[model samples]
Target: MNLSLFILLSLFGTILSALIAFISAKGQGHRAVMILLALSTGVGALSSALFLLSGQTQLIVLQSAWLFGTPFVFTTLSALFFFLLNTVACLASVYAIKYVEQYAEIYNVRILDALMAIFVFGMQGVLLSGTPFGFLFFWEVMSLSSFFLVMADKEAASVRSALFYLIMTHLGAGAILAGFMILSGESNFESFTRLAVLAQNLPPATLFGVFLLFLFGFGSKAGLVPFHVWLPEAHPQAPSHISALMSGVMLKMALYGFLVMVFGVLPAAGTTASLIVIALGLLSALYGVIYAVLERDVKRVLAFSSIENMGIIFTMVGVAMFTQAQGLSDFSHVAIGAALLFAVAHAFFKSGLFLGAGVMVHAAHSRSLEVMGGIAKRMPAFSGAMLVLALSAAALPPFSAFMAEWVFIQNIVSNLATMQPLVQGVLVLVLAMMALVGGLALFAMVKFFGIGFLAEPRSEHVAHAHAPELTISLPIYLLAACSVAIGLCAPWILKTMHFAELTNTVQWHTDFALTNTTLNPFALFALLLVVFGLVFIARRASSNIQNERSYHTWDCGQPITSGMEYTATAFSAPIRFFSHMITRTKKQVIATPVLATNKWIASRTFSLGLRQIWYDGLYVPIQNTCLWISTQVRKIQNGVIQFYIALIFIALVVTLTIAL
Candidate 1:
């Protein structure tokens, strides 16, 4: 089949699905619409995979012009991202079938289904867009659709979260616009191909300025540290399926923008830019994981974990940028490949984790880990799937995340010998930071899984928790399976990605043993399977010889209560104490009198609070300054026409003088 024809059909399918969903919103056909949306997404994914496998590297320009008379370009890179976007969309849609049923009465189910379809469409448009104008148009569509999705609950908090997200998104978009306008300049070339040539002739200072603009622009959307305040607030407010998409693929769209700007447009951006990227990525990774470990809210923990994973991805991207600047194409290939691999792995596992969180939240009637416990016995399937996802997020062996990180570490260490002493020292620090981030990630996941699912129920809600329906559980299971499959098939997946062509490196080894890498997940997985089999056989044999007995544990002559169980807050207490400076943790204790005549304490109340250093120290000051300036400007608005005219005349005169 023709590549363009396949893309066109997929696009039509998505649009048709959205239309049908809108039409069916007020009726009993919501489920059917959702199923159709999933089917459409699956078709898109298949088309994208076929395009990539066909080795269609040449850009296919859409004959029909989009907004601003700009065409869309479908290249191998775009096809790869399209595959990822559609694959996740398909899973989210499937999960939403049962998940949204709970909200069917409270919210507009039709709007939710329609927005999901449109969101996927907008993402596809962004990837395929050939010009800045077209990309920005679709970018706004994607952002707005998600904003409404975040505000779907219509609670005061969700509304506030949506507004926060809206502001940050536009700020990022404005930066991108400014950078693109600067690139276009007098010629005003709309096509990226033309802009690439124009960008090469720009002065060093001008190029660096453009790079900074794109960094802040794309970085904000990517949830890089100072600009990341909106993420934790916004993600948890959205419906769980939407949250999965936002964390899984929406952030990756920002990453797609970054890659295009840095590699495609400003290939000449040198070591200084690369160093800055590396530094920011390192800081975000460390900061994110530390907060994840300290967080008590279930969705908030997952939100922060997304930030940490983004940091790891950006760190690998920085390594690729550095290698490319130094003309080390081989190392650059491996670094960028690792980033893409991690991205795909993260999409699968993180989406699964968020879906599982939704089920837990529904079962426990809350999003707090403090309220949840001992759900594994009731929700065995969910517990097992969530465990797989948590381990993957923790970057343990026999998972795709571990393989990607392993590849990243290998490249960083291998390239150190060829660098200057100062560069080598920086690389060593980066390596150490990566190790620390991985350890903290494991700690956070353990807190997430162990607190939310393992022990006795901490509240009445959790005590009677039930498993989610098959419709919801199916998607989680599929995603978990993908995470494992990707790891075991790492070598073939790497080869098929065509990193060799992109970085001018040799074809990767095609052995199931992963012969050229430090560790082989396939071999490790087989070994683990054999070990489990042996242990199971031994246990069975022992059981046959002697009858098994079950007994309740003695509580040391005292009755135990759920209150004695370790809460999520208590689990993370030590980490919070050590990182108090960064976390800005505060505690309060209040004592109440038992009687008016006596000073005897009746009860004590304790509470803990965590603060964002960036929000308080950086953004708050900027916000206050803006408010102060606005207040001063308001003083001039005295409802006088003469005063407004005089101000306008003075502004025109100043503009004329500057123009002359």
Candidate 2:
């Protein structure tokens, strides 16, 4: 009934959902379990988060002596992530009722549902926890739960992907633990409040080391570059609905951690730290979009795009840090607000797109883009919803993403006049980098939509595709609709957060709809709505009036075929061609002449795509070094009791000598 009850219900009810899923596996099935999970999350968690975000900040610190004597405390920022996690997870449960049904025969749906429920519970715990001990405890719960989900398919590839994810995540956890230890200092204070107080007195170098540790640790979770290798692999291997949770909701947990450390615990970043964060963010944005443009898998495209969006969020974070350090408190709040807004927008749009991807993959029986086509004509309503999500992903007009980016860009541009020349130059370069990132992001979304959904059916599987059930369909459209609502109501949302002390610029708006406002998103939304309505009516009327079928007269008796449509490889060929040095594209061609006399006639096969540059250049060498070390260590583990005894005796003698 109350916010505290809701939070408690959200936490325990999640565990109840998992228990129900496990116990009633044979009797109730996934639908019932999913509904319980959804109600637990949507009604309780969602309400609490929404109420908190609406400016009713509640403080709940419950004792957890049984675990580690730490308490559960909910901050405004935690409430923000609570809203995001539950919102996406709620919709995902509905979608999962259908999507997981398809995989029921292949994998244990009950186990999957249980794991998913635990996964959500773990994330909720992370958001609710007050200290690093509780945070890492629940963090492992989340990671381990997802690791099992990734390997649910029980295929060799899935297992390998899961192991890779496990290794990377553990390394990240280690880094986070180290950062926490540094912050806590000698007294071993586990509370974040105490840690922050202690951290303020630490030396500059030590604090900066903690900052770097937090970045690497959280960046790994957020799917940033160099630490992003696990994301694409693990997302594709997991069930599609789970992929939505991972990309849309789970990644934001990392953002939550990073924000907690940088804005809450650690002091303001220096120039060097700010520049490093900004550079990494920019590099991640560019690199991710490039791969998104190059990839052919549906989920992989979304995964890479998630990297790009997270990059944008982190860049805003860097901007906030830089502004705070420079004594521009107002602008710092504005930049961080932009980051927060983008995170919210991404939570909806990216989840919607991933669920939409699941629908496509389910209908077509493939994740490969090359095999899917003509979905726009069959599932036109679904396609329309997906178009909204795709546009949001591209940061196009009249979508929440565009508004978020506009604020970030506007903040930078507004300050260019007042800043020093060096600072102005840096901001200018950031703008340019973001512009390029935006363009490539648009290109990637176009390829994702056009090649996968618009053309003639590229394969037999897609040709017979049908629409999904209402359970599967409704949640995605709701998410898509949020993009428009978020865009139109941007000013009000920002104003509310500003009032709650989560954002800035409550003073800029007299009314969002009024003409005097710097940006009237409502006006833009109305304009687009009218244009789209008119076009839709015209198309409907034309279709209704024309009884006779029209044919292409230029066909010359040769019927249209899928062979005429562009392949995924061909569509992205230009990017590979132009960015060869970066992409390191490899090509091979084999040809045979029809006849020796007919030199001009030949049948040829060709292949081209991005080489695994990061894998080969970075990870592979590291893997090799580890393997070499493992071999050297293996020599000491010989199967001889006498040698082992001698080694133990030598170790005991060394211990005694050191004690003396």
Candidate 3:
């Protein structure tokens, strides 16, 4: 099959799915439409996977014109991302079939379905596009579609979040456009191929400027720190399945743009620009995980964790850029491969985690971890799936994330030996940061799972929680299975991805061996499985030998209460204590008098608040300045037509004098 025809078929399927969803909005066939949408997305996913794995590297021009061309470039990099977008889209659609039912009463079901299809379509377009015009067009489509989805709840909070997302995303798009126009010049060559050829002749200063523009532009969308305020706000406000897609796949679109601009368009800026990227990535990794540890909202914790993972990905990209600049092409490829592998791994586990969060939220009627406990007993299937995803997020072995992170660490360790002492010292610091991020990630996930799924119920809502239907559970199960399978078979999967073929600087003795080090994930996974089996059998035998007994948990000297159980806040209290300077935590306690005669206190209330340092320190000042400037400008608005005419005449005279 021709690659262009294959891509066109996938596009058609997505568009048709959107049309069907739009028409089905006014009818009672929403479930049926969603299933159809899932099937359509499945077809698209299959097609993309086939195209990517087929080892085809030809550029397929779907349409061409004088000003711009619509071409699909099938590089190893683009193909990998295309596969990521389509795979996540398919699974998210399936998950939403039942997940969106709860929102049907609160939102327009048809609009939700239609927007989802359009979002996937726009993401695919961004990955497949070979021209700046097409890229920006699809980029806006993706952003707008997601914005509407974030606003699906029609609440004041969702509206505010949507507006923030809209403003930040467009700001990024504007920066990207400015960089592209500067590069296009009078020739107006819109194609990336042409831009790449022209980039070689650009001066160093111009290339560096373009690099800065792209870093800020793409970094905003990628949820890099400082520009990342919208992410935690928007992801939690959006519907859960949409949250899954946004965090799982949509964030990678910005990565796609970075890869195109930095590696494809302006390779000359690699050495200088990479240091800045590494710094930003380190900050994001540490800052994001710190917040995740303190977050009490289940979805908000996942949102912050997404930022941490994005930081890890950006770090891998920086490693790639830095090694390539230093003329170590093999090490560069290893870093790039690690980034790609981690991306695929993240999409699977993170989507599953978000869907599991949806299950918890729907069952408990709250996103607050403080309100949930002992949910594993009520929703075993969902909790089990959540446990798998949580372990993967913690970078445990026999999970996809562990494999990726191991490869990343291996790349860093391999390169440290050959670099200068200063560079080696910097790498050591990066390694420590990565380790710190991992430890904090584990701490956060344990809090999430333990507080939300274990011990006594914290609230009446959680006590009545139940498992979701098969429709929702099925997707979570599939994603969990994929995470484990991908990790266990990573060597073969990497080989099938033509991972080695993506670079030519070095040759490997085997699929899993990088230079001297060999990774047998399957062997490690099997050993863990055997150990788990032995423990399970031993527990079962011990239980059979002894008589079963049940009793209430012992309290020290009084009756036990749910309050005695560890709360999410208490779990993170130590972290807050140590990091108070950065987290800016505030606590308040107020006592009320019950009896006027004795002036005795009846009850006390304790409150805790966490401030966003960037939002408070940076955006607030800018926002206030803008408001003041707007107020001053309003003073010039007068009702009198004569005053306006006089002002215009003076402005015209000034313009004429400057022109002369």
Worst 10 residues of 1 by lDDT: 503-512
> Ten consecutive residues with minimal summed lDDT in candidate 3?
500-509
Put down candidate 3 lDDT per residue, 1-660, tens digits, no spaces: 666676677778788878887876363666776676677667667766776668665446366562255675566567777777777777777788778877678878888888988999899889878789888989999999999999998999999999999999999999999888878776674688677777778888888888888998999999999899999999999988899999999999999789778766775446668888888998998899999999999999999999999999998888778767777666777777778788898999998899889988887789999989989988887888889999999999979998888877876776688887756876788899999999999999999999999998888888887778788888899889989988887777666666423223233223333323566888888898899999999999878555777778878779887898999999999999899899997679888878766667467899887899999999999999999999999888968899899999999999999999
* Total backbone collisions, model 3: 0
When 1 and 2 are scored with TM-score, the better candidate is: 1
Candidate 2 per-residue C-alpha lDDT over 1-660 given as tens digits, one digit per residue, 9 for 90 to 100? 466767787777789989988987462567888998898888655665566665654467477585677687766778878888988888899889878877777778879989999999999989888878889999999999999999998999999999999999999999999999888877765688788789879999999999999999999999888898899889989888898999999999999999878766787679889888888899889989999999988888998899999988998888878767777767777778778889999999999999999899987888999889899999999999999999999999879999889887887876789987767877888899999999999999999999988979888988988888999999999999999898888887776653233222212221222122466888887888899999999988878556777765466678888888897778998987788788887689988898999977998989664566777789999999999999999999989999999999999999999999
- Whole-model Cα lDDT of every candidate shown, in order: 0.85, 0.85, 0.83
Q: How many backbone collisions does model 1 have?
A: 0
**What are the per-model numbers of colliding residue pairs?**
0, 0, 0
**Candidate 1 wrong stretches, greater than 4 Å:** 25-27, 59-61, 499-515, 543-546, 586-606, 651-660
14-111: candidate 1 lDDT, tens digit per residue: 87878988887383667787777788778778988887777666556475754777676776667778888888888888899888988777678888
When 1 and 3 are scored with lDDT, the better candidate is 1
What C-alpha lDDT does candidate 2 achieve relative to the native structure? Answer: 0.85
Candidate 1 — what's its lDDT?
0.85
How well does each candidate superpose onto the true structure, as a TM-score? 0.94, 0.92, 0.93
